[model samples]
Target: MASFRVKGGLKLKGEIIPQGAKNEALQVICAVLLSPEDITIDKIPDIRDVNKLIELLSDMGVTVRKNGPESYTFNAAAIDLDFLETQDFLDKASALRGSVMILGPLLARFGTGKLSKPGGDKIGRRRMDTHFTGFQKLGATFRYDKKKEIYHIDGSDLRGCYMLLDEASVTGTANIIMAAVMAKGKTTIYNAACEPYIQQLCGMLNRMGAKISGVGSNLLQIEGVGYLAGTTHTLLPDMIEIGSFIGLAAMTQSEITIKQVQADKLGIIPEIFRRMGIKLDIIGDDIHVPSQKHYEIETFIDGSILTIADAIWPGFTPDLLSIVLVTATQAKGTVLVHQKMFESRLFFVDKLIDMGAQIILCDPHRATVIGLDRKYPLRGIRMTSPDIRAGVALLIAAMSAEGTSVIDNVEQIDRGYQFIDKRLNALGASIERID
Candidate 1:
């Protein structure tokens, strides 16, 4: 496994061109199954999850070719659906939760899909009940063999129906929408996840001649078409990475500019950072964070203690909350971070506490951070990465600390971030990849 050894107390300064959004790229690549012609996607991140999906597609007889570093051409016209039942296919499909997205398109186009249980960060109990229930509502039958962990789906023609998801799951909504795009009638999905990734999926589907409305809202209307054509599309910038860079610049007291941020897609990310007294200037599509001595946490409206919490769409992303919590440790105030989405996500704060940060882990889901405000820079320490977001959070914490630190289990970081070490190096971070 690869590890990162970072020398701390370095002020990172330079411009970083963010890579494509991993979430969007996953869904977009899976959409290729809906067409018989070649589909070219530009700016796709070369991350582990994407590569796994590419391997899965290739195993199913889909022709996948990498035309460039971040570009791919997919031709799924000759895919063999029978491979979905193999053990090798199941092993690859279980690597990431995003693998379940292929189910919708495969079932829609070929009338059958077999997949194993999907695996991802063990944050909480991620249920596929919503996905199966939605598919059943749209004229599909589901059969599960628990012993084998294989799910079999079959249907003659998908018929549109009104679907109210149990929860606004990001991948579940994408799956349902992909199935609905080629159904027999109109599918109205209420309480849909309308995050930027979903918005981009909807836009791409529209470009491919699928009629979809309510692109950026909780309600989506999709008119089923007989067939979808292939089209070239460029992905949006990674907003989560942008938020991570913002936290890195703030904690390290660095002046950095993030290029091609797609400010229109950052719903309330900037405002959330502003609450922590982090100033950001948007130069066109670029986000610039100026160097500062320290940051102050803003309190609530009645001068009471403030708390930052995450919710569904239109609210703060739970993925970025870890970075926010770590960033608050070096700020000038106290704030309670409530990560309601995942129970085990807040457990990483113990590592920060080991590094001399004053953190009160209330429970499995909450933590109270008392900022040092430059009184004490976090001292270097050895830590293990728990997951993708927490791994990046630890990297930021290590970069802002004094002396040296070692981070083990970097595979978790590589699963999501594309060429993270190279990107951070461009920003002048003193980090080296050691195997």
Candidate 2:
């Protein structure tokens, strides 16, 4: 129950090297359980979710060796299946939604996996039907114990089969892919999630001797291999953090350089922000945001108002919508911020409204932000951080507001970000974390 005491209106200036992809790292770390050999992963972010998954692995008796500050080697040869059935394991694993990914590797390696209902951000209704359905199609038996609220999956005779997913769920596709890698026959997953994270996982699994084809595409074909050997993989820069930084710099009107950004992989994020009338100078692999005195949203070609909504891959990421919505507060024109993936994500706009923002929450999924154009500076107030993305948005709001703001629930922010306070402090942001 910690809070951040932030002094607003400081123009932070400096360079920030984005952390490793948190979402990608989660999937890749779980893929280590697919192989019994030495699997080395580099550029791992030291965040709460990653650490929680690693702790879950350690508790399950996996051999975890820290090679350096941002590297680790995992060997799943001695994973204890008996530990997975205990209440102690459920208590720890249920706290993190990433723990659900372990089902695939565990079922693939040990022929059985057990899990309690996983917990994560309450942004919307995140269904597990896609994951369970994919597993059932792979010749596995899935049983639910409603009394204990546990899912029991037994893949004793798991045989690969062709199936199409109803939705392209990132984590669900990853879980199925991990399980299919060691199955007895060929497995084809149509309508799979082909994000950079899933592609990286497939690439790493391929390097480890799994036969996977059509990478970076929704139609994935995997030929089951008897076993997978160990391999080393390095994660790309966190694109979410990069976008967050872009919004942060614009909100505070600061000049900041983001170093080592994988610019090519960040599809449409920079462009989406540009539509909001913010300028971005891409110097080689870095993105530089200059101090802006004014920014205005652009209308559509037909003279209609601009609408920015989230969708699947090759579309604007849902994670960055919160930041984008917050950045639109000081803009000169109105824009519709549509969050289609999650239902309750736009509820955080009420907090922004309290800070003197001109926002109209149309419904659960859409909000129209009328730009204040800095006519009146926002007055900071006490607020609570709801989820990871919303928490960062509030932090950005607090940093650009006129007065001091106290944001409670720092734990929600820490779950996804890696030493955010310490890192932002280096860039001249006055955020004091109090316990």
Candidate 3:
């Protein structure tokens, strides 16, 4: 029940390096269960969710050794399969949504996997049908125990098959790929999620001797292998954090340099911020966001209002829409933010509204923000963080507001961003963690 007391109206300067991708770390860490050899991973973000997954792995008898501050070597040589059925395992696995991924590798290698109902941000209804459905398509028997709220999967004779996914779910696709890699034949997955995280997972699987093609597209082809070897993988910089920093710079009128952001992989994020008139300079791998008093939102060619919507990869990411909505509050014009994936994510706008930002929560899925244009600076107020993204969004709004703001439930923010208050404080912003 910690809180953040943020002093507003501070101009941040200096450089901040984005941490390793949180999403990718979850998938690849679960992939360690696919092999019993040593797998060294670098650039791991020290965050709550990722650390929970790592702790889950350690509890499952995976030999986890810290090589450095951001590196670990995992060897799943002597996994205790009986642990999955224990109450302790259920308690730990139920707390992390990423724990669902472990079922795939366990089923692939040991032919049995059990998972308690996974938990994560309460943004909306995140169905597990995609993950289980993909497993069933790959010859796994699925059963849900309603009394205990646990999922049971057994795949003794897995074979390759072609299937069209009902939705392009990133974690679903990753889970299925991990299962299919050790199947008997080739598997083709259409309408798959091709985000950088998935691509990185596929690339790591390839390096580990699994055959996968179509790295950056919706269609993925995998040839089953008998066993996978160990390999080293370095995760990409978290794009969500980079986008948040960009929004923080614009909202607070600060000049900040984000170092080694792997800009090429940040599809449409930069342009989407630029559409809101945020100036970004891409020098090598770093993104330089300059200070600006006012940035104007761009409209369509036919004179319609600018719409920033989320899509699959190569489109705007839904994770950053919260940041966009908060950033647009201080812009020169209006922008419509459409958060299509999650229904309840835009609910945080009510907090920003309390901070003196003009926002119309049209519905659960869309919000229209009329920029105050610095004529009316937002005045800080007490608020509560709803989710990871929204929490960061509120932090940004508080940083650009006129007074001190107390944000409760900052644990939600820490789940994604590693030491966010400390990092931003180094850039000259004032954020104090109150325990």
Q: Pick by lDDT: which candidate is best? A: 3
Q: Which structure is stronger by lDDT: 2 or 3?
A: 3
Per residue, candidate 2 scores C-alpha lDDT tens digits across 1-435 of 899999999999999999999999999999988888999999999999999999999889889999998999999888888898788999988899999999998888889999999999999899999999998999889889998889999987788999999999999999999999999999999999989999899999999999999999999999999889999999999999999999999889999999999899898999999999999998999999999988899999998989999888988899999999999999899999999899999999999999999999999999999999989777899999999999999999999999999999989999989999999999999999999
Local accuracy of candidate 1 as per-residue lDDT tens digits, 280-394: 9999999999998988999998987679899888899999999999999999999999999788998888889888899999998899999999798899999999999999999
Cα lDDT computed for each candidate against the true fold: 0.91, 0.93, 0.95
| C-alpha lDDT of residue 420 in model 1 | 90
Model 2, position 269, has a per-residue lDDT of 94
Model 3 agreement with the true structure over 1-435: per-residue lDDT tens digits: 999999999999999999999999999999999999999999999999999999999999999999999999999999998898799999999999999999889988888899999999999999988888888999999888999998888899888999899999999999999999998899999999999999999999999999999989999999999999999999999999999999999999999999999989998999999999999999999999999988999999998999999998878888999999999999989899999999998999999899889999999999999998999999989999999999999999999999999999999999999999999999999999999
Q: Model 3 misses residue 435 by how many Å?
A: 0.3
Q: What pairs collide in candidate 1?
A: none
For candidate 3, give the lDDT of residue 168: 92
